[model samples]
Target chain A: MKTVDARGFSCPEPVLRTRNALKTLPAGEELEVLVETVTSRENVRRFALTQKCEVSFDETEDGFRLIIRKP
Target chain B: MSDRFTRFFASRWGIVLTGAVIGLLASLLQKAGNPPNMGICVACFERDIAGALGLHRAAVVQYIRPEIIAFVLGSTLAALFFREFKPRAGSAPIVRFILGVFAMIGALAFLGCPWRALLRLAGGDLNAIVGLAGLVIGITIGVWFLKQGYTLGRSYPVPASVGWIMPVLMVGLLLLLLFQPQFSEGGAIFFSESGPGSLHAAVWISLGAGLIIGFLAQRTRFCTMGSIRDVILMGDTHLISGVGALVVIAFIVNLIFGQVHFGFAAQPVAHSNHLWNFLGMVLAGLAFALAGGCPGRQLFLSGEGDGDSAVFVLGMITGAAFSHNFSLAGSPDKLVDGALVVGGISTYGQAAVILGILVCLVLGFTLRERFE
Candidate 1:
């Protein structure tokens, strides 16, 4: 699993980072994104889902950890 | 308490309320003595602040507007209270800065930013329709760029103190506003004796309004550019609904205050040049989209410790100086022998707009993740 720690960043940044990281991910590989804001979480999830990646998340103490599997 | 408050603001109605409040306050500010149809213009206010600081010699628009100073301070306070202040930087800072410069140039060419464009419409300036259309078209182009994996790279976290820079500078501006210190009578700082810079709401009232709006906006993440971008990219109307509320409520308030004068000619602080109005906002919209926020949103971001946004704001101030010094800003129409001579950008201003568009296109195309 590859981790893109987007903690403490705002919108577009997190989503953009997630997209960039997903570009190099091979099929069936998993990527995790750590974000500290609900806005970033939703945005990253939406972007991932649009790209046909399977997405799910777990709420952490401060924010959320999104797990994405590239198809 | 804070959790419930945050959740509420995240709800749809909360966002609408935020927009409505902003609309109400903006109209009231105009009625209270701010420039006509310009109660709260981030771009214009920043321009005035730039002139006040002697960044430009435009005497008619020089004042340390308290509202602008309070915006950064208010947002910083709100971010601190909410524990949302996260200082970060290093994401193609130069690109963002250049985008900001072009954004201001484009805005001055139209004599307004996105907020002022909407305000102009609400106050019955028919010229704003063209500007709004241009903004939409520009955002659509940016959306295309985003669809093609456009990115400005990623920002890394920095020390918390780094985030306080903008807030401290804002505080310094507040001090200047309070003291009005002079370095040999208009040699250092400048203030407008007449014109839009001289017209303003009371300082305390303006400060209060700025602080309130900044706080609410920070909490809700309100952004005009984001509203358009989200609608185009995600089919989301959450932010646009807020924008709609702002326009609707402002219109109603303007109607009640007798500020509605429907016309394209002789509108205060506005020109009647349809083509430049459209093209100017087109440049501004594209720059805002590329930079990831509108002027107001950038200020809020700076308040919350985004160094990249701070740099963008500085670029905007500098751009204002450039616009005035180089005669790239638009002029209001004037009555000549009972005929309205349509005002617009100068030849140099037109060229600047074209150059700005080309620069934005180049930046958008060259900064993509993959060139396939």
Candidate 2:
């Protein structure tokens, strides 16, 4: 799994980061996004899901870990 | 790696504190004669700026607001210091401009922006509830559009000189203010002798306040619309917390200062119609979300050389002109203070906001985005 840490970034910035990283995902590969705010986490997940990727997440101690898979 | 206050001010706590300070300052500005609860309304100030420039002939709302001029100049200085000034534009300029126009129309109908709405509520006005609800719904609709793959395209970098235009114009406007060509002797500028337009903080004080606020807000990336958008779109409360502090602190300060006179009846510069206030902000909120920032944020962006934002700012001023010219703005009852008008929504104002919302939605849904 490839990881992209966006914990300190704000909205739209984090979403933009996840968007850029999503471009590199090959079919069947997974990307995990780390974000501190619920808004960022959900936005990243939304972006991934909208891209036809499968998405899930875990609310961790620090924040959230969103796992996305390109279909 | 810094002083205690510096460290705190730069952190999340700093942003909240900044908002609280802003809230208190707004109340104080009001007490010092800034037209009731309108100490810092970007939309209203811009409108007044427009009237001052003779962009419109509205007798009551004409004055070159030093605060707005200072907002741009101060932001420019801050951007220069931080080396964040890079001029950019061409992100659907025409569309952004149109969005700006409708945003003003909606705000005029509601008689306040998000900031004023919050202040009105703090002063014990119940009417802001509908407007607040309208803002949330509007942003929520924008979120729906976002979910459907809506995009305004991306902004690309332009020559750095391009970004200098807005700041330079701001300087010119400031010089114009100091020299204040006389409208009395048929001087080229318009000056309101009375009404909200006549009411203002001393020029230097307002200018200083504007500069401070512009610098701080630019540094903090503070925005009310962004706060609500973040919440509705992503459940983000980071920005919302700052606004929460603003309201709370303002409420407290208003109480201490004896500015808190709550109720649905005759709140400062506010009308009683709940429905129009709600629908009006819905239009404004949708327009703000679609344009990617609020009026103040747009000014900050313009200060940093974003031509797109500058164009939007111009659009808002033009829209303000049209609103007053066409009687599409709110006014108080016939026997009210100035009696010239304010606070109640006009029929045309209602029509304008509805049209604004419909047109913005069409623009939103029609712009197809590539999901693949």
Candidate 3:
């Protein structure tokens, strides 16, 4: 499991960064991405599902952490 | 609060400047060729499109506007470059559609949306004052709902393909306009032979202006309703200042260009119905509030790949069709199907605003702020 932090980025940056991170990981590896902004949070969740990855999101003090496991 | 808004605008001058430039260009479009009261009306253009599609038989207001196509395409590019394009849907879409319909209905009844209504007033059409008032009242009501706790629920994730649906449709329409088979005469498409429908800026000019404005507005988050709403709710005046600048600049330009024609006797395509103007905008204001953006904002949002806003934009187009088809739209000849439909829809729209406010109130009181 590797964590890719993207907490300060706005809008699609977080989602795009997460996608980029996910691309490097091998199959069955877990990638953790952190993002701020409600819209971005929702976008990442949706992006995860679209990529056929399993996702679980949890709220943190500063932002949100989306844990994605690529199948 | 004012400082925050000021900072927001200052930090995002590109957006605000783009909005003003779009406004100026739209005015230029009117100067180049468009109806008197409508230089760059989203509702009016959509109505024209509806008529062109044969959804309405209004011969006078049918034209395939290139500016609309430019708006979507420009926004598409911006979203793609910014990587902000994500197409998702199904968050109370039906409600959004309904709101769109009523918003158009109300705007037509008023003879303009918030933008056109303001432009009308600025152009010295005094009747617009009433409509402007109604818009404020309606928005105030919506803000009341916001204070209460009204929510439109949440939009879930959908495929990226969903976002491209509208852009694709726009492309198809453009292709149809360009590759019109000369052999097919009066098949179904309607083009205005005369009247407001016949008047238009050049296709390239319209589209170019739209694309520019779309890009700028997307960056700035400029919204007419949001300007007023922020002022009323939190004493924020950033967006409103921009709007004020727009009005002042437009008025100055109109006067200098000899476009200022005072008195309301026969103001270019606009009627003199006072009460309907007020009531119509009230309906529009509420709908805009509930839906979370004005027609222009919706366009920009759609450009940025918000599928929900795209649906609402379509709803407005469909509503325009219904308005003209059912004779619910106002015409200079008559008062838009008497008072029955106007009164009925106005009442329904107001009721929806109230319901939305009540729901918001309940939610506002009950839902604790997780951050707070």
Candidate 4:
């Protein structure tokens, strides 16, 4: 699993970071992203779906943790 | 409902007052140093910025405008202070982007946005009157769509950090301006060597004026499209009255400052293509209507942390690039392709307006609650 910390980033940053993380990860590996904003969670989820990845999300105190598995 | 109009203005006087102040300051900026008929144009300035960032190669209109930077920052401060700052998105982001693109294309075709269009008319550019008419017509069409169920969708809550994208970009640009980093020979910051882009007030003055205007506009909700929209839709003249006040005041100020020159032939940074001016503004007005606000209003909304508005703004910047790159934008020298592009775009806009109205009518009849 590759974790990308994007908790404080805004708008496109979280998505951009997630894309970068996915790039470095091998196929079928999990990429976990920590994002603070609800928008980012939704965006990441949407992006994961578009990229044909499976996503499991859990809410934390400050934000949310999103794990995406590349297919 | 009666009080809604009154309350809107009461709460929004800040927008009106700031809009007027911006107008006055823009005039002053022009008088002092900026280009003629372009004291502070949001679309034009953004186009310059896009060029500065190497988005397009429009040599004649490229310069980084500080007023734009100040607008976002000032609005950000105001929103933060008022606790109205909410960063949200996902209201059909792609659609908003497309609207922004069309909006820029229309504005450039008309040679101005609604604010500048009005100012252009006030300054005796008769072409602007045509543009204004087209704007009104376009808004009327948009209102029809509103009467329908044509919404961009809903915005859900986003992280506070999501709102900082444009602000951070602005800061980065300001840093570039301050540092003047070595990029290329001949000051390739994409500044216009000798055109409309070359004309500008000093950076500090422009930024200061923009900040003040942004602060005031955020408070007033002063929107050119909304002014007409309210008056036509509900017979509420509050916003329209403020708009009228702006025109009269601007004219008076122009006269006092010896800026009101009569005749249209040699007007600064404008052309005498009356038909195209009308058509161009028609496209702009329709795009603004579909997008739900004028360019200035979009900027203010973005400042208040509206992601949908921000999307529209980015769309416009991209549209500016497209227009220039595709030769769809006009210039004082002559119309691009000499009337063909104008006619084609005008037809497309009109068709879109007609289609939009038809859709609205259908939705209005079908989607009503029918609470008889």
The candidate scoring highest on DockQ is 1
- lDDT per residue (tens digit) for residues A1-71 in model 2: 88887764434655766776777778899988888644456557656766788999997765689998888
Cα deviation at B181, candidate 3, in Å, is 4.4
Instruction: Give per-model CA RMSD.
Output: 3.0, 6.4, 10.4, 14.1
Better model by TM-score: candidate 1 vs candidate 4: 1
Mind giving the per-residue lDDT tens digits that candidate 3 earns over B148-204?
Answer: 544454454557787788788888778766765333577556778899899988777
Residue lDDT tens for model 3, A11-63: 33455567667878999989988775344575577668768899998877656
Question: Tens-digit lDDT track for model 4 on A1-71?
Answer: 67887765444346656776787789989988988654467657766776889999998876799999999
The total number of steric clashes, by the backbone 3 Å criterion, in model 3 comes to 7
Indicate the worst ten consecutive residues by lDDT in candidate 3 chain B.
B363-372
Look at candidate 3 and give me any clashing residue pairs: B145-B357, B148-B360, B148-B361, B149-B360, B149-B361, B149-B364, B150-B360
Point to the candidate with the largest TM-score: 1
Q: Residue B313, candidate 4: how far off, in angstroms?
A: 0.7
Instruction: Write candidate 1's Cα lDDT for A21-71 as tens digits.
Output: 899999999999999766688678768877899999998875799999999
Candidate 2 is scored at a TM of 0.84
Best-first order by DockQ: 1, 2, 3, 4
Docking class of 2: incorrect
- What TM-score against the true chain A does chain A of each candidate get? 0.96, 0.93, 0.92, 0.95
Per-residue CA lDDT of candidate 2, range B1-372, in tens?
233533454456767976887787788777777888787889999899889888888888999898889888888987777656767777788988999999999998888888888888888888888889999999888878866767676566679888999999999889888998775665458878988889998988888888887887776667889889878776666577888888988888889888888677667777777788899899999998888788888898789778888999989998999899899987753435655332577778878888999999999899656543
